[model samples]
Target: MQQAGIPTGSTRPFGYKDDKRTLEPAEAAALRKTVERILTGASPRAIAADCNKQGLTTTRGNGWSKETVKQVLRNPRICGYRSRKVREFNPETGTESVRVEPVLDDDGEPVKGQWSSIISVTDWEAVTEIIGRNPEPGDAYNARKYLGSGILRCDKNGCGSHLRAQKAPASRKKPEGFFYYTCPDKRSGYGCGGVRISGPETDEALKMLVISKHEEEAEDRQATGVPEEWEGENELARIREDIDDWTERREQRLVSKERFFAFLAKSEATERRLVNERNEWRRPVLRAKGEPIDLRGEWGDLDFVEKRAYVEKTLLTVLVASAIRLGGPVRDRLTPIYRGED
Candidate 1:
């Protein structure tokens, strides 16, 4: 077994060292810090860059890459556990694989502490499952598709400045085909004094706003000294445990011919809450994995209403003073309403 890449002794091999042994507390802490950095908004590439900047070496003594970072994340040893499998290839028969049962104690639970863990077992599972999703274009539903659309309103109290479109000619020879947005209150007999911006110009402004907002949020997180990588492992573990307990209770009631409806309701409620929490975590991860918005490319895919909604959501209202009509296609000019922090 030792000659076949299997350990013969009681000690387990660690990736970080040439001679494998259980991780010491200091090594565990370092691993945890690395995991926390990855859990934050940083991409694997970014994490690798940071680690290299700090002069840290991987188990192979080489600089870390995104692939290496991902591999480490997938390692079960990080959860202080190990897995075993046996593979066999036959000439007559197809290749076959077998997983040896875990070296269990009297209670049948797998042994623990084979290595250090950056995150808890439960949290690690959640993160790996998330990493398995498709990342190609059109595989994700982006939430920031709306930037300058009229649907986005001032988050302030009682100052909901409405937006409306304006039509203008692109050239002297053409009669129409350009459009823009402005404060609807300016024409609705309200006291909204705003300027007009061209449709294309407004689109550009909204795109800039979206990019700027992303930057601002990142900066805020850095400024507050907050731990960007929160350990959701506990919450996830609790949710799973709750579901299992509820399910067992529900089954017992049904088997005993007693009222199982109450147990069923409790289980359903717990499951719903867990699902909601999971979705919340998933949305940001999905967004982070999404491609950057291509203003020109996406325009042809959306019509007036869809474009408007996309703009409204993506832009900060203050950045869009108003949409004004400029020379372009027939429906060009628009006035944008900007409600800054006055």
Candidate 2:
């Protein structure tokens, strides 16, 4: 039924009415707006909050959540497509798990559903790619309120753990806001537990460093020339999809080894080159309209998600040390390494 374009399920999707196939005007509109906002750099948490405020609920009549928003956007059904479960057995566990993948026809084309799409295929892919990668945004608790929460690392005696935002009382060095990017101690069952830096100060320092690096990259691009928009995103998606399909076919014994290996050698080489190209064109900060902006001034306006995404892109890691070990000044206590740097 789904392959023939008829939407089917135990319960109608969030944007559909009781009939299951027809779109509910209000719900569909909200879904569309949410997709647009996410593509424009709005975090899932922000969108989920907006939905809950507007009295929107999931198909199960529960409040909106960041994970729910991501799941809905990643679903191809919103783009008028059908998906099926690919069950694979785990050898070690002696159990099977399943993955929901797009339903493909015999000709290797996606099965188009009969229901109308809430968003275009292009927009849908972009949404999925964004929500799916760059550290794969976790649940609400992991939504990230601090800029350096996950990006900053503890460099205490090789006890490397991602620093988290912790509350602290006012101190002489950190006089305001009363927060620190403190490393979890043995009580947390991990980490050196000794690294604690002023939260507000660390955030400000990292922001400026990222902005400076971004500025330098932009200046370098001026001579070499850069594209107006990031290209090959859709192409990369297609390549990945093709690779998955090829592997699935082999696992299912639908294709012989000779055919699979022939495709793999060529596909893997192409995927590698595209990945390198993407890394080269990486922009650490992008707010809206995909244009250059004044990072120093506009940095405060961006939400936590955007700031973290930008920082993670530009720097592989920010290895932070305690005041005693990292002497000199606040800036000297940390080392920022650019992504792709050795």
Candidate 3:
């Protein structure tokens, strides 16, 4: 008897035929397009919505969902690797653990299948990294309810604590409680000087900053004649070419092994950085198509979660400065670090 190679299952992955031995041209194209969109900063939710709007269905013939889109993007099978489920019994715990292990070739690398690959290994890895950077939805208490709750850095010159939301006690002047973003140093008694800022006031100031910076970016784009529909596809292509060139150089013995590895690491790092920047660059275009940038007219209409996502996607960091006067208001400095701008 001979050992089985690829599984002869009735069902196949989305980008392959039912026999799993050939590429379904349309499906493969769709998968590649999705990867390109993701590299340009399309969120899973946005991609899912677009798929459904276009009447695209999953491998199982169901409408696409965010989780479904994410699972498809994360699937190694799309890269032409074969995987199998292994079950292990745990006698001590009276349980079994199941895991998917990729089949390896003689070279100890993941075995390539007969089917075509829809995405390159590098692009797949970049998509995975981008997905990992996004925050997951939370439950009741853990949900983001205030802007800058998880984003604001400590005001102390050298302290690195993140500010957390604290509810002020009810009083005669204000029966309802108010929220303040206080430094974790004070909350945890770490001995770093404390800083607190009014949540509403800080939120409003941040909104203004977002609006002003967005306008500036728009003007810059107009002056530079950058296309509104431009994505980072060209830049990604250049980075991929550089990576291939370095690999060829190392293979041809034109560079020392140590130097080759160092340069390869730097090239990969630059690729990741470029992917992030491309995503940021596409964000404004996506927002303009989907949601209105009503920072002034409809600012209060957005919920806490939406507002937090907006801020996190737009700004890299918000550094709060402690009040100069003992009883003065705390000040914050914004860094419009999105779109690879310093």
Which one wins on lDDT?
2
Q: TM-scores for all candidates? A: 0.40, 0.54, 0.52
Per-residue alpha-carbon lDDT of candidate 2 for residues 1-342, written as tens digits (9 for 90 to 100): 646756667878878778766888988898887876665446777677778878888989899777778777777888888866566776997877544567888756799977778888666766666677222323324367788877888988878898889877555565556688888887987787888887877888998899999777656544454456568777888998999999899999999999999998899889878865564444222222343445665576556666787788888889998887543567888989889777
- Alpha carbon deviation, residue 34, candidate 2 (Å): 2.3
Clashes per candidate, residues 3 or more apart or on different chains: 43, 2, 0
lDDT of 2 at 212: 96
lDDT of each: 0.49, 0.74, 0.66
Q: Can you give the lDDT of residue 45 in candidate 3?
A: 65
Candidate 3 local lDDT, 1-342, one digit each (tens): 002236456678898888886889999999988877666445566677778879999888899876677767776667766666567776997877554445776534576666677888656666766665222332214367777766777757668577778787565254355677777754467526567777767777777776666566545544554355446678778877987887788879998999988987887888778777765655445344433333444345445554566677677777776666664644433333453556
The stretch of ten residues in a row with the least summed lDDT in candidate 1 is: 131-140
Alpha-carbon shift of residue 60 in model 2 (angstroms): 1.8
